[model samples]
Target: MRQPDIEIYLKDGDQQAVTDWLNATIGPCTPWRRQGQTFKCQAANGAPVTWLPNAVGKWHSLFIESERTPWEDDPAFARAAFAALGVEIRCAPGGWQEEDGIDAADRWIKINGEGEQEFIWRTQ
Candidate 1:
């Protein structure tokens, strides 16, 4: 079975900064090629990744499309990103499930000020 894609959202940081951080953390990626509003590149592990800067409000969305990515899941990526970029990052708690539906519960895992992951349930 295909592994679930890893998704994460950044609270802040420009495109260049995010690309740089990804290179350093997940190993160097190929030069970013823009495709409309999103930028795509291949991670060191050969996973296809895309970065959509400011895709959601002020948060930048990133998607790891393949299981080849070095990290195992969203929280793993968020932890590494928070450490490297020192920025708040958000991701679905325990990854996303279609059965839950897009508006189902709307819980998230966000990095706190003390660099800890916190689970938050959005009322909306």
Candidate 2:
């Protein structure tokens, strides 16, 4: 049960706390899309980033947790924010393996405790 690297794309004018950023206080899927299978995104001041495909399942909900103290942490805000964004979070387990659709269809996101795992958020 290993977690993937979680890269975050913050906004230029975003001066919020780290937890706020993870909570999606500014927005959900900063530079999100619903048409194409793959797309690129850029932060307010950073360079461009890309999202191939994180997972499949009509994109119900999304959440993040720490592998060390996952159970001890509270993801209420994240869950609510995701719901507002149109997703339905069902479960969240850290230190797991996942292969998001970036390489394949939404059928990826396999939690195998391996390589580069990140969230690569967009704000532009």
Candidate 3:
């Protein structure tokens, strides 16, 4: 079966920086022109992507809602985002599941400020 859609979160980074990276690496990204999204773009492989800022937190969401997304998976995107943005990144380990055991639902694979990948339990 095809892999699920990729969802990654940014802990801290300027929206413009993210926009620039997306425009350069993915495809030309334009202002979302929608109520909730910050930007909207298509990946090179033709997947729809959106950047959404959290209303009340440092974390922001990026959804690549197609199996055709360029990156292979969440960690791959996280690594690329870190290389481009030089900021912390987070994603559910191995993608999110309907019933992920071992309390993995709340766990994340984080790319830290220094670009080290580690498992973390996020409280916020």
Candidate 4:
């Protein structure tokens, strides 16, 4: 089976906020580990999930394997998840962003709250 794509972007540089959002959004699961500043976790299905901290900007990103992800097929759940985190999700792109003017097989989401963030999931 092909791996699904799901990405989450965060606005601020607070790692705890991201972890809180994940725990609240995804439910109580395994605890994420801190590798330096980034957080990594494994889903119940054993899919590797990671939350990367910002290096150049305040934006943070999350990469998850959507095939076994809890909210892959449900955008509402994802949106609600973010909403619960106190962040508003503006655009969850079905494909690539028009402003980027790039072509790719990845899916993405655009967020506008606190700080700008994005999530990209590779479909191909």
Candidate 5:
């Protein structure tokens, strides 16, 4: 099957980095769930959110949309994506960061802190 769009978000709401990534990849998925959207239910992570997954994996997501996704941000999913990816994403005073690095044995996206985020691509 074809790959789906990858998405990112800035707490700052600049959308520049997300836009750049969008241009290079499949496409960006607009947030169907926003701050004011109707409360569908409390997420597994306990975040009050709206919307549900329209499809399964293939795209990178900044937030959790479904239990099928394997992201550490979605703590209660099947297994911690961190466990599968072997990368630990942590949050600190600065921002979201990752130091464990993506594991060669698995696929992971680590969150190191809350500010000044970065990407550690597979090649690097």
Candidate 6:
């Protein structure tokens, strides 16, 4: 199956923070199991997805990956989760072609709070 172009970015929290939020809300939709250094879950299509606590290159980032589904499969699920946590967010739809001719993120989520923080998703 071809995955949709979807990705999620978190700007205000670390992996544990995001994980706790996910597990708290919509966890019933899909539960996660902690692996050695990451949390693992399966998409509705049975494709594996992972959430890394300490992403090497990116600090305090949580990523979602699945072979069968785009990260945007259920954005509302995430929005609701964030809302439940009282976090304000602004999302920018991805798929923008930059002036540099480089492919940009498929989606960009900006957290309205202290510190300059945002998350982006790139899908090809």
lDDT of 4 by residue, 3-115 (tens): 36666555563656755665665554478888997778876566677777773265566667656665643244347546666654433444344685544334455544554
- What lDDT would each prediction earn against the true structure? 0.78, 0.31, 0.74, 0.57, 0.30, 0.47
Q: After superposition, how far is residue 15 of candidate 1 from its true place, in Å?
A: 2.1
* Alpha carbon deviation, residue 20, candidate 4 (Å): 3.8
Q: Summarize candidate 1's per-residue lDDT along 38-112 as a digit string, tens digits.
A: 999998988888998887778899888986765688888778778777888887757556888866548788885
Better of 2 and 4 by lDDT: 4
Off by over 4 Å in 2: 1-36, 45-54, 60-77, 97-124
lDDT accuracy of residue 21 in candidate 6: 65
Residue 121, candidate 2: Cα error in Å is 24
- Model 5: lDDT equals 0.30
lDDT of 5 by residue, 1-124 (tens): 1112112222222223433332233233344344442223333333332332221232223443433222233322212322333333322112122663335213333342342333433422
Ten contiguous residues with the weakest lDDT in model 2: 6-15
Better structure of 1 and 6 per TM-score: 1
Please report, as a residue range, the 10-residue window in candidate 3 with the lowest summed lDDT.
29-38
Choose 2 or 3, whichever is better by lDDT: 3
Candidate 5: worst-modelled 10 consecutive residues by lDDT: 1-10
Candidates in order, TM-scores: namely 0.82, 0.29, 0.79, 0.57, 0.21, 0.44
Residues 60-91, model 2: lDDT tens digits: 22223222322232233333333343232322
The sequence of per-residue lDDT tens digits that candidate 3 reaches over residues 25-45 is 867754555655466766666
Candidate 3's displacement at residue 43, Å, is: 4.2
Q: Per-residue error at 30 for model 2, in Å?
A: 8.1
Number of backbone collisions per candidate, in order? 0, 24, 0, 0, 13, 1
Worst 10 residues of 6 by lDDT: 1-10
Off by over 4 Å in 3: 37-45
**Which lDDT tens digits does candidate 6 get at residues 1-124?**
2334334444444545555665553342257787787677754555455666435334233444443432343354336535655454444443344663543444455544452344554533
Q: Distance (Å) between predicted and true CA of 56, model 3? A: 7.0
Ranking by lDDT: 1, 3, 4, 6, 2, 5
